[model samples]
Target: MGKRHSELLILKEIAELLNTGTNMDEMLSGVLKKLLQVTELDTGWIFLMDGDGSFQLAARENLPPALCYQNLEPMCKGECWCTDRYNNGRLEKATNIIECKRIEEAIEYNWGETNGLTHHATVPLRAGEEKFGILNVGSPKKTFFHEDELALLESIAFQIGTALKRIKLIQKEKELALTAERNRLARDLHDSVNQILFSLSLTARGGREMTENEEVKETFAFLQDLAQEALNEMRALIWQLRPQGLENGVVSALCSYGQMLGLNLQTEVKGLLTLPGRVEETVWRIGQEALANCKKHSQQSDAMIQFMIESNFLNMLIKDSGCGFIYDQNQELPSLGLKSMKERTESINGDFTLISHPGLGTSIKVRIPI
Candidate 1:
């Protein structure tokens, strides 16, 4: 094929390999196979630097999949011959494996060898100017990769590095979302079950004391009422924990949160409130957790919550006149409720801050993309 035509064919193959809709390992294997075909290398290997900066053999030509999964720490950082080439930023090439000091050392260590490789070139995989790993190509003959061939190999490395960065970013996003979900569930469990347990303990103690005096009898009855309120709160917590958010819509969920608060909660959703799935879930969880915190921690008998949707964004404000705790007090105990709310806010790429003072009032403001 002509040079331009060959380049275009390689690009086409890269695109198709990326769109294979397979798992990451399978995808990497397929991409490496395609690279070998396009470059006609005797043997090729892909090394990846994991999140912790440790190198691992991600893919290899003719290597068993199980062996390819082995980790290779202290890669070029060690006292190997390849280490010298990598540290000096020089691509090593040799006609004889024995003449290549690095290959000989690596072979002696049983790490890798040039038994089937004569001419070799190592391409560094870089993402945005940061080198993440090396793409080493070997040939059975000498000087297999010329300047043009090396350029093509470097381009492949760039493509692989870009894809790896994208995949890592996507996985990180999913992890953040999962972490937020776990925090929300944990807070719900604490607020509901723990509160009920406290209520039960109070009820039992009050009942025991009521047997001695009629005045204590009235207190026991009050405890019964409080227990019932705890039950209602538990139900609300369960509803919020449901994976599905506002099946009817954001408006419906906002209204539900309002009704659960037992106050005048008005939701004026202007523009479209249809946020991204993760964002929607995050906002709903934040709202639910905030309202529950208001009821549990606020001394206010009446609170107000408003949800407003505008161009490309959603805004929420919840205010209550209650015994507010100091938000910035380092000596104060950290509440799981506050931590969970903050995490949820971060997960949605939103901002959440509580304005409050002891015996004054509390106001929570949240702004997120719609």
Candidate 2:
């Protein structure tokens, strides 16, 4: 096939591959594999960056021994020419990246063999004007990329970036739908069960006053107290389902929730509450679970929550001075809901750490890249 016709064919096939998956990692890996296969290239990888310029090694295919040394340590850390140019707004098109810095350092330091690969063609991944990351492809002993080759790489990178944008929009739509459903359920519970509890409390109070017998009067008073307690618990649960004042921000919402649980929260926040929607929601839900567990296990009315953001990451800490139970590695902490908290944190690729002792207080810490 003519070179022009072959490049067009590759683009067509890759466009189809991008649509085959909604997951960003799986989609990028598949597309990179296909790109290298069709172009007869030796190596390729993808880097995905968030708004704050922090990047992750999203996908890779056919790395040299030097680059893959020590479980991909070279690619996972430290900035190189391509990443620096992209972050500084210097890289704008498919161009030959000067000598591969990472592999060059590897060779100089004798990390491992690079298989004679010293350079790559790099292109920025963009959806419209919003640039998110870069795609890099290389071949052994091929230091120069022709105009046609660079053009093809640019075309495929556009396809991949557009696919990423589509998947993220779908995720946001799903989240908004869930929020609407939760609001509906909250409304239903308040109108039905809340009203019923209110009526029960009033009826018990009337019964207590009407009863002439002392024993019957005492029984009526006890029933009224029980009904009032149930009502309070239900209100707290409702707030959990649809947290109050979350729009004011996460820390504010947690404080309001602590009030509902009758726990005094001493919270301190550092940095602005600038967080993505999904990230903010995840943090809020985990905080809610941690606080509920604290109230149930701590037997103390005071708990502390700390929020801090640094280096494009969010760190959340919830702690309580309570009688912490013995931690057994063989089993999960069901009472404190440790498993639930851990799963939620990991779902967003965040780190979860728990520290507790019999006499010492319990602390749950979660860190997530913003």
Candidate 3:
């Protein structure tokens, strides 16, 4: 194909990828695929510079699933061919090893063994003066990428980079709102219900001691016990709300939740995972829903909820040998509580699945991207 025609085709593919509206990971994968098509490069990789300016390999094609690109961290933090070109106000291609030293190294280390990236091009990905990352493409044939090829790649990188930044910004905003809502809930419990319950406990204790008649004394004792239970509940609520211990990670959050369920649930949360705001909110709601369901139906004595984080996703499993109900027939018009939970999850674009066979049991699993 002619150089200009190849460039146009690449641009079209990039536009399609950006408009895909899939999750961030999927979008990055699509971008890499399109870039490969454009340059016919034998090996390529995309490195995303995190807030700390350290490069984490965002996407790679020919690597094993378990072989994490994480260890393949970027050598240079903020400096690369793309950044240098943008900084120097030149989008020219680094066609040779001297011009594209980093690009050559990344290829040799990341995919050079398999794909043989002897030559490559580097493009700076920028969005409104913000340096997001760099796009590097390499080929087995030496001097495969020319100056015009680099220019074309740069334009494509610009398109993808801007979209990535925009999506990232939106995700951040969603997270901030979720944090604010959590803080608000915590404050409400601490100031209102917690204080009232505390006072009630004291009054009930005093009332019990003052009672005289046997019947009255028995009644007073019951009242005091109820009051104490209420106090304990309030305390647990406070813990869940404040969540200092759970603040370390999602594992703690799930463990605390299981303990509060008052059911001996072997809960496990794993993975170096962080969730976006909306996704977290959905998870919180799902947790609340499963607990509520258990309280109402899981008379089976115990329940188990497990959390596992893998790749860019979170896997949540809530299993209870509760009295299973028929969910296939539109079941019980889910109560407002269940409806609310479903809505919250759907709002953030997540999956909510409830599996139960009449005599089998109930298992609720939710998969969301982190």
Candidate 4:
């Protein structure tokens, strides 16, 4: 095949891979592998800028032994030459080939094999003016990329960028749909269940006042209390279906929820609490579940919540002084509420831990990296 025809064939294959209906991570990894195959490159990687303005190494293929042996922490920290330039806005074109400082340093210190790579070329993975990331490819002997190869790389990067944008749009649409459904449910509960609970409370109070028998009066008073508690629970459910105080922050929302549950909630916040919307939402949901668990399982009427924010992470603790259950590592968790809490925490790449004993109180701790 002619050189041009060969490049076209490779591009066509990559285009097919991108359209394979896989998730974004799998698709990008497949694209990187395909790129390395077509170009006979030793290694390739992609760095994607996340919504929080942090660049992360999203995918990689064919790492050299030396690079693989080294700790990944440095590479992921955006310390490499290509990523540094990209962050500094110096890498603005498909043809920008830069020497690999890490490779040079490795050679200088006789640390590890460079896999014959002295330099690598970076192409801006962008759609028009909006740049998403950098696509890097390298070979042992090639110090610079040819114009045709640069063009091909640019084309592949553009395709990846377009795919990423499409995925984001689809995710956003799903989130909006979910929010709409939640709002509908909230409204329905308010109009139906809430009204019924309020009417029941009123009727119970009237019945108690009209009854003169001491035993009957006591029964009516108990009924009235049950109705009132149910009303509070229904209100809390409505608030959760559509968070009202979330605009103020997760702290405020949780406090409002605790009030409805009639639980004595003590909250402590340390450091700046500003977070991304998704992060805040995740925290709020987990908080709701934890509090719900406390109300249902804990025999105590008080709980404590703590929020601590650091430079790179945010931590949360929910504790309840209630009758805790025995925990078995080999057995499935007994509470679906705790299981749901774990799932939600993991979805955001956060850490979750549950501590409980037969007599000791249960505590939930979460740490989410921002």
Write one digit per residue (lDDT tens) for candidate 1, span 1-370: 5966885887788867665434567767777887877876657676665333335566777532222223533232334344344456553321122234444445565665345544456777767765556676666655555677777777777777777767767777987787679668857786768677677857766695759777777777677677777766666655666533377776677667667667556445556556666676777777777778777778665777777776456888878888987767344326787778878887766887778888988888888754
* CA deviation > 4 Å runs, candidate 2: 2-9, 328-331, 334-336
Q: Candidate 2 residues 1-370, lDDT tens each? A: 6886886787678889787679888889889988997789999999997666678899999899999989999998888999999988998999998799999889988989898899999999998998879999999999999999899889889888888888888988998898899888889989999989999999999999998999999998999999998999888778877999899888889999888888988999899877887788889889999998888888788899999999778999999999886775456655546788888899999998888888677899999988
1-370: candidate 4 lDDT, tens digit per residue: 6876886787788998776534888888988988887887878888897545578778888766555545654346536767666777877787646687766666665666667877788888887777888898998888889898898788889989888877877888888899899999999999998999899889888998998998988888898899988998788778888987888999999998887777899999999999887889899999999998898889998999999988678999999989998987677767788889889999999998998987788999999988
Candidate 1 lands at a TM-score of 0.48
Number of the top lDDT candidate: 2
Q: What TM-score goes with each of the models?
A: 0.48, 0.93, 0.52, 0.85
How much is the lDDT of residue 160 in candidate 3?
76
Q: Which stretches of candidate 1 lie over 4 Å from their true place?
A: 1-10, 19-22, 50-54, 63-102, 106-116, 212-370
lDDT score, candidate 3, position 163 = 86
> How big is the positional error of residue 343 in model 2, measured in Å on the Cα after superposition?
1.4
Q: Per-residue lDDT of 20-78 in model 3, one digit per residue for the tens?
A: 64487788887788777766665566777644344656676543212223454343233
Q: Which ten residues in a row have the lowest lDDT in candidate 4?
A: 66-75
Ranking by lDDT: 2, 4, 3, 1
Candidate 4 regions exceeding 4 Å error are 1-3, 16-22, 51-53, 70-78, 95-97, 104-114, 204-229, 321-334, 356-360
User: Which pairs clash (backbone N, Cα, C closer than 3 Å) in model 4?
Assistant: 116-140
The candidates, ranked best first by TM-score, are 2, 4, 3, 1
Per-candidate local distance difference test: 0.65, 0.88, 0.66, 0.83
